[model samples]
Target chain A: MQDQPLHEPQFALHVEDLTVTYGAQPALWDIDLDIPPGVMAAVVGPNGSGKSTLLKSVLGLIRPVAGHVRIFGRPIAQGRGRVGYVPQRSAVDWDFPTTVLDVVTMGLYARIGWLRRPGRAHRDQAMAALAELGMQDFADRQISQLSGGQQQRVFIARALVQQADLYLLDEPLAAVDATTERIIMDLLKRLRDQGRTIVVVHHDLTTVRRYFDWMVMLNVRIIGQGPVAQVFTAENLRAAYGGQLALIEGGAVDPADPHP
Target chain B: MTAVLEALGLLFQPGIVQTVVLGAALLGGLAGALGAFAVLRQQSLLGDALSHATLPGVCLGFLVAGSRDLGAILLGAFLAGGLAALSIMLITRATRLKTDAALGIVLSVFFAAGVVLLTVAQGQPGAAQAGLSTFLFGQAAAILRTDLWIMSGVAALAAGTLAALWKEVKLVTFDPDYARALGLPVLLIEGVVTLLIALAIVVGLQLAGVILMVALLIAPAAAARQWVRSLGAMVWLSAGLGAAAGITGALISATGRGLSTGPVVVLVASALVLASMLLAPERGLIWRWGRAARARRGIAGRRVLAAFHGLAEAHDDPAYPTEEGMLTTLIGRPGPGVMERLERDGMIRRVDHPPETTRHWELTERGHDRAKRDQGGRP
Candidate 1:
């Protein structure tokens, strides 16, 4: 594990007893977690695990039924510029007419504030971020012309241009090819190396060990979270993935078993 | 020609030219900007349907007021158009009926109702009923300065609202989910955009007529889409294009002896759309094909270099390979006279063959190097 220099004790993200609902159904329930600064952690769960909802709740995208979120010991509003997000590939209309460079430049829009145009310095930063993601050649190409992997890379580049301290990426690897995945992983690691905190909503559990240093196993609730070795136990896995019925059957769950 | 000139003089003397141009330009530009959002939302046909739906309102306005004043008619048109849009929204959300079918259904039924009322209005005992027919086909010659002022105000208001909420509108248009996740009020933004569209259509009923207002809403925006990538640029360019279309339509309809203004304006707008669809920079068909052709040519040039590299790897042979057979096999039938083209351009040399026989070809070092670099292959 890479050593990160610690300052005063301030968590990068703090979600205290958060609960969210969609009509009558509970999307997230009593979730409490504190993410330390400069760690790259993954939120792993099944399809209905409220991963996206949890992220949205933290970002104030969705109103929680109960609880609060703080960034760097303060509310999210005070650290708005310190948080950058990369949405899922399918969430955007790929046929949008904007080019890669145009999309990437949108990250600075909030920073550049309203009505003011982005200047050469912003463009240089955007291009540099694009180059970091190896998307420099496709800067002028319309988003529709890009393959799914390239579009994911372009989105990651957009996030990189934000220069945020804490980055929240939603399914950044979904629909991406191997090369794009590698580039994105490398970029996340580089950001981590720079003492920036990253929280990724990731799907591939098998590659979790290879890509992320910290893990949060969630199924509508946080089963456990910590260093990989501490949180990757069979007990936690069963608690995260197993139902009460499965727990009654055995502590160990079979992958082929319907109960598991 | 003399009668036409006399009529033009009469039209201008009455100050109809300034009225129609200013009215059409403002209304059409407003519709164009709001219509860009509708177009991006895949709701262009919805505006078309609502424009036709506004006819029933126009007829009802005439029946109620017994007057041909623009305000009464526009108010009625707004109600009818708003009803149509709401109905479409309800049907789409409540049932399996698609947006296009819902639009078609509303358009046909409302248009039929309007036409029936129009026929009834023709037999009514009022001179005001006579002017109602022009709303169906738009007599631009009849627009007064007051009407132009109304349209200019509507355009100014709509444009200002759009400009003020440009960021939220763009975010909502492109990715409502992302906007929602950002805690942006996406539904409110969509409501504002739709309200602007309704306002635009209600105003366009006077300038381009109910029957042709859809053209005013869609054509300029669609044309501008082919030219620009940003919503702001598209709106600005669409406004300019709409103004140009309006002026051209006004000039031709004013100068021509018998041509109606609405259809002429629609036709001119359609022509601009056609030109943009074929020739505009980004999304134009011609530009896409041109780019694809260039890419293919580049790939072919790479293949030629691949063959050269293949030959270079074959042996340290200064014979520099010769055989039209192997070149054909290597480059895969180089487009009719492409081999001859390569030879003529001095990129490839042909040697050891009769004038008619299959000639062997080899690349010069310049061609060899160019192909390798183009393909990102070894030199």
Candidate 2:
């Protein structure tokens, strides 16, 4: 340890007894999780599995009934600068009166502080982030003009400008082209290789072992979590999916299979 | 109240027409700028609720002062508008009803209560004055110098806050969740923005009245959104359009004896919205129609050219001359001007028809290249 702020230095994300409710209905119940630093992770299960609820709870946007979520070895609130988020594209209004560059610039507004505006240097930084996602030419174009994949790239660019130690993305690859999917995956891997942790809410079960090294199977509660090869087995997938097993590919992973 | 009515009558006198117009413009500008945020956040009805909610406050202020005091009336209006907003939020939060139902509930209930209060206040001593009713439909000519000063002070505060918190406000309007994730005080910022909007509505309460003030709040912003693609431009244009509507309406109404300024202003604002919808450069209806028309022409031209290419391919000859009848049969008769327009653009040229009754045409090199390209490099 470098004598930094850490209750547990090994885990980049720590969630204990995390419970969330929507009105009287429990969305997530008494969950516990520990994800070590610098691993690309996936949270997978059938639809309505509390994946987005879990992420929002960790971000402190939703009020959870009971939970403690730590990021980079600190409380979620204290780790604001250390965590970046790529929310679902549906979370924003694309037709809002703003340009792509301005949307990306918003990522720096918190760091830029209040009562001050972003200047040339800040814009240059935003331009560079946009360039990384191949969206530099669209910096001045209005956001409503972007395609779904371009919109996803713009969001990833915004997150990139944060340069946080931990990143959480909700279904970035869903509905994107294979090329776009590869580009985003490569970008995430690059970030992880630089010692940052990446956690994605993924839907594609076939790519789980191929794309991630750590897995967290969640369905209202944590069915299993740990290194992908260790926790991602046929038995765990069946338990997480249950009656909705046919909804997703619960049969994708076989207990006897090797890296299929 | 008599004095206020006297002031209204005085503005019609030769010297102060500009003063009344200026006052109305300021009111419109303030409403328009704040309304930009309200419209963006999809809470335009919130303004309606807040404005109507101020009616009871105006009655209370009149009762408490025993006379018409503009400052007391404004403060009371501010508080009441704020309370209405809070009530709407609470209604939506405490129950499953969405914002629309909540706004409607607060608007009608608060306005009905105020009407009842107005009747009660009419019976009390000194509250029997007639000018207090001007707050319902609004009489712009009734604006006093003190009222103008109060409006200016409120406008200044709004402008100052918007300039200082421009980034946060834009971000909050666009994505409050992301703003919160970035450690911004999402709730506090939202609250402040909502309060500023309420303040703007309160200030416009007397100028446009409770009934028509929401037009100034929503119309200008809605119109401006059609013309601009940036929040900054939308707000500025909204303010300008609002001011324009205000001045035109006030001038027109002031020319007539019984015309109320509020309805006239709303009509002018609505006209501007209609104009923006029809004529804005990119988002306008006419522009979209024109673009669609041009696209249709291009597609038709491409198909005609591709038809020529098809004839050349079928005959296994590169320089085949196709008769008009044959071309028509290949793809149903091209529109009458389709061939002429293509020839005018130098994509095709007519040839003399020998031993044939119809005109024949051949594609120029340009037309041939285009035809080949549209068909993905085919024959």
Candidate 3:
């Protein structure tokens, strides 16, 4: 993989001076980032930070006040089909009368187009995705009947069925059980190994080093972003978290590793 | 019985009765199908506001056309309803006012404007405003053949739209943010849904009137919701229920002396909702009540068995018969007929002691096994 010609390897995501505001208050200030393809990256930050806002901006759910976001070195609209998104679990009404298989089938709606119902092939693809997430048995069950972990897995399965080259998740591990955390982490690693770029809005500082290859510490603006081992340092953590650094400082950082 | 036969005969003969029935049924079905989305999205009141908001548009349409041209009136009503919906969206999005407040504000303001416009139109020197008042309370008997044609066209459009975009609509209603992220043209889908709802309300004005039309939209869907667990089933059931209510109400009203059709139709839909609330399985209030009662009885029976096991273990005799007073004390209530129920259930036995002795209970072997299982085998 390293021997190939490198003419500025196209980044999976490129943000230049992106800014977002809600009303008069700025939710995210000027921010710039470039994430290389095939890396599992984590956007870590304190509460009230623009972690979710950034993801929304990239997905075009929220219009940025100033600047642009490019996916695969092209506009988001041009490459939207290649991008899959897993929004926060809380963003949806779980009580909606839909089955797991029905939700997974929605991933294919963009491909199916208007007036065309999903056929047997779409159903088979959905089932295959559910099987990959170990959720095949739950295909017929209403979404509300599933546990938190199972629901998160269903969301993941929905994204998986998209078969996109780039995946963006917003707080996928929040409120999930340990089993789900493990399942998600393993699946993310596998996707990365298969050359898919995955970016996640992550909160657990302890798992950042172990689960992600790259890190972007943000608090309204980009604080530091690079290889996890280099940019995920005590100084950068302090800069992002302020006085609340103690909560994440203990047991999460390796003091023996020297920082340059 | 003669009156009923007469009414049925009149209904079958192809006149005002047939047109009214067909128009009511079409309106009911469309409202029901669209109302399912409104109910699911928790926008039932939004439907009310939108319906009321269409009044101004109806008056405006009548004024502009100088007559009650069905097409012109409907077009005007659609535009007014659409504006009301847009204003509600804007108020909620651009200000501190919540959705309920926005709905209330828009509903009342638009309705007042409609009333004023209606009065102005009524006073016009040459205007034939005799039937204009029917839009307020909806005189189903006044439906004409042309109106029926309009109703059928709207119904067809609504049904076709639902069929073509069923999946997209469901996704947007359930999770618009996710739909937007998937680049699914979330705004366009939402606009289409709002348009369909406006169309339903406009076609319904002649049959149900604007004031009571929302009941047609909400009641049938809300009733069907009690019986179904899937969106597809809910949509179909809601449509059927709406049609049934419309036909039945229209027929019954036709049989009676000078009764308006709107109230009758709404009453039938309300009856369906009440029946569903009381009788539908799983989520019905009565079913839940019964389940709770059964669960409580099971708990009491288990407590009695546990008391029996405790006494037997203490006395080192499996056949020990504990008095009813002891069992009551363990259960924390007299529970008047619990012992008899347990005995009938074969979980307990009445031991025949001396004639003067108080009745004592002993656990049957089956009862002891159940007690152990219920208590998780804890001593």
Per-residue alpha-carbon lDDT of candidate 1 for residues B223-337, written as tens digits (9 for 90 to 100)? 9888886678888888888878877787677777778777888899999999998998757899999899867765665676567667866876644765757767766776645
Candidate 2 lDDT over residue span B1-379, tens digit each: 5644554565567445666777889988988999999998998888889999999998888888778788788777888888898899899998889999999999999999889988987887766554777888887767777777878988899899999999999999999999999989988888988888888787787778888889999999999999898999999999999999988788777666778788998999999999999999889999999898877777778889999988888888766888988877878877757788899999889887678867888888898888878778443
What are the Cα lDDT values of the candidates? 0.78, 0.87, 0.88
Which prediction has more favorable DockQ, 2 or 3? 2
Highest DockQ, which number?
2
Task: List chain B TM-scores, each candidate.
Answer: 0.85, 0.91, 0.95
Winner by lDDT between candidate 2 and candidate 1: 2
Every candidate's DockQ is 0.29, 0.90, 0.68
Clashing pairs in 3: none
Question: Which residue window of length 10 is worst by lDDT in model 2 chain A?
Answer: A249-258
Runs off by more than 4 Å, candidate 2? A1-6, A247-259, B1-14, B316-319, B355-357, B377-379
Q: Report per-prediction Cα RMSD to one decimal.
A: 6.7, 4.0, 3.5
lDDT of 3 at B13: 92
Question: For each candidate, how many residue pairs have backbone atoms clashing (under 3 Å)?
Answer: 1, 0, 0
TM-score of each: 0.77, 0.94, 0.93
